[model samples]
Target: MTIESESDHILFLSRDLLDDIELQRLEADKLLLKCSRLARLSGTDEIKQWIKLEMEGYNGSKELSDHYMSRTGRWTNFAERKGYWGPLAQIEENIRVQKLRIDVSKVESLSGDGLIGAMRMNRDAQQALANGISSMVAIRSRVLNMLHTFVAGVYYERQFAKVAESTFEQYKKDVDALIAAHAGEVLEKLPSVVARLQEGNDEAVSQALTTCRRIIDSFADAIFPPQAGTYNLGGNDLSLDANKHQNRINVYVAERTDSKSRRTRIRQNLSNLYDRVSTGVHTDVTAEEAFSLFLNVYLFLGEILHLGVAQTKDSVMA
Candidate 1:
């Protein structure tokens, strides 16, 4: 499949899955609220009073026990005094308390119609639904993060973080080699570039990429001497050529295998790198991606330098 098609496929898949997850999340949230309300409503005032008594460290009501044992419907022996008492009523209250216990216990297991006691609700289904919502939300978060980077066309940001640990070590070695081979003035500013590129901060990485771009431009200038100076000035103002940068890149591309060469690939990569470098310096660009782009530029510069050296040797021999 083409890259465009693949990207569209992934985008659609991510969006659809995220929509389903959001639906589940909403359902779970609604169920949770319903359960809470039911738990509250199911608790009778008497039950709350009983629970409050326990919460307040009251062992039990002594007067009720005394009145119950005496088989009196009054709070005391004084005929003029009256207080509520009924063995049947207390029995009925106990039954209601037991029913309340069952109703409250079902809160966690409640789902479908059982949420409202319309039908039996499977506890496992309820748990799975809740868990699925959580799992999907986490996945959705990750997918959206990647999609944001992808949609922005910042390919490196989505890719660099997923690079293997061993690959990073290899890249680190390449950086060290580049430093060692081009020490002194050629790479005087590059000692910390690799380190900064590896930082978690995007700003630092963008700075490093910018540094690499400058180094590449300077190296290109050194390799391809400007033709403007070669022409006689004739006492007229010697205006520097505006297309010198493009001319240098064209010269570099011309030295390689003709139409069959990967020169186009090089140019495209360089263009993307340049765009990203500009964005990195001026706006927010993920550091890892900036570093990845830096690696591409570094490799391209190395090839350009190698080719230039070869051509110089051939001319010397001639």
Candidate 2:
């Protein structure tokens, strides 16, 4: 199916990949191939690149140059473990702990009769096998999540675009000045963020993260200014503070009973992103991570702005 036509039936593809991953029916290479195709259909450019690294390996991907899986050094910790049973069942790493990239296509999987078969031999051959299949599995789950969100976004954007057309002229007249200033400033950041990231240096990474925070900060200020300390919601006073985008964003989302679930999801996504952005400010963040963080600001903003314009529908008509 052509990209446009098959998009209507994307859920089918999503479910197929889900089934494959859940059942462990496909090898990492085949699974990544499927995910890469699925991702190309509806995922963002950045996410598509993330998947590409798995399929093609980080051989020549400049954006992910820092994350190349060249040295699979067992990584920060438990990553060195070959198997997980009972006490070894769980694996945890710090969120800041970066995962080593692997080219799933290259990993040679051990095939035998489960535990009994796997115990039969110890290859101890990382150099020989180059096991990147597990990293491929992570991509499967990620692709599923990104697909769901991207498909939903496509639907939302279409529905909102229709309303936006009918409501645009009137809405602008009422709230253009205040909204435009923040929106314009936010838009202006796109170029600066691009320039900084292209530099591909530590300082550039920091600048990119700072820009991410600025995007959130500007969006928060527009929707829920810190100057407005108390948000009177259903007559309950919820507090707000400067630079505290999460609380302000939650308050913004809470105002909409009809969409609190989706809006809250968006807020939480941004909240998690904000934390990552904050972490990058203090720690070393790759250009890849910084770019992804910046790319996401606009994703949530689309839903937020759609709801935002709806919030002004009555005032505009009045």
Among these predictions, the greatest TM-score belongs to 2
**What are the per-residue Cα lDDT tens digits for candidate 1 across 134-228?**
43344334433332332333223233433554586786566545444543344665656777877758667767877876766665555554665
Model 2 lDDT tens row, 1-318? 433446444545665666676676666567667776766876777767756655554433253433423222212233452321111001212111223322332335655567444433333333333344454334344544554454455555544654675586564444334445447676666679889999999998898888878887887887777865677754667678785677787777777536656755776697788889888988999998788877676556655665666777866898
Off by over 4 Å in 2: 1-182, 232-237, 313-318
RMSD of each: 21.0, 18.5
Model 1 residue 169 lDDT score: 77
Evaluate model 1: give its TM-score.
0.37
- Sequence-dependent TM-score of model 2: 0.41
All candidates' lDDT scores?
Answer: 0.49, 0.60
Model 2: residue 95 alpha-carbon error in angstroms: 62
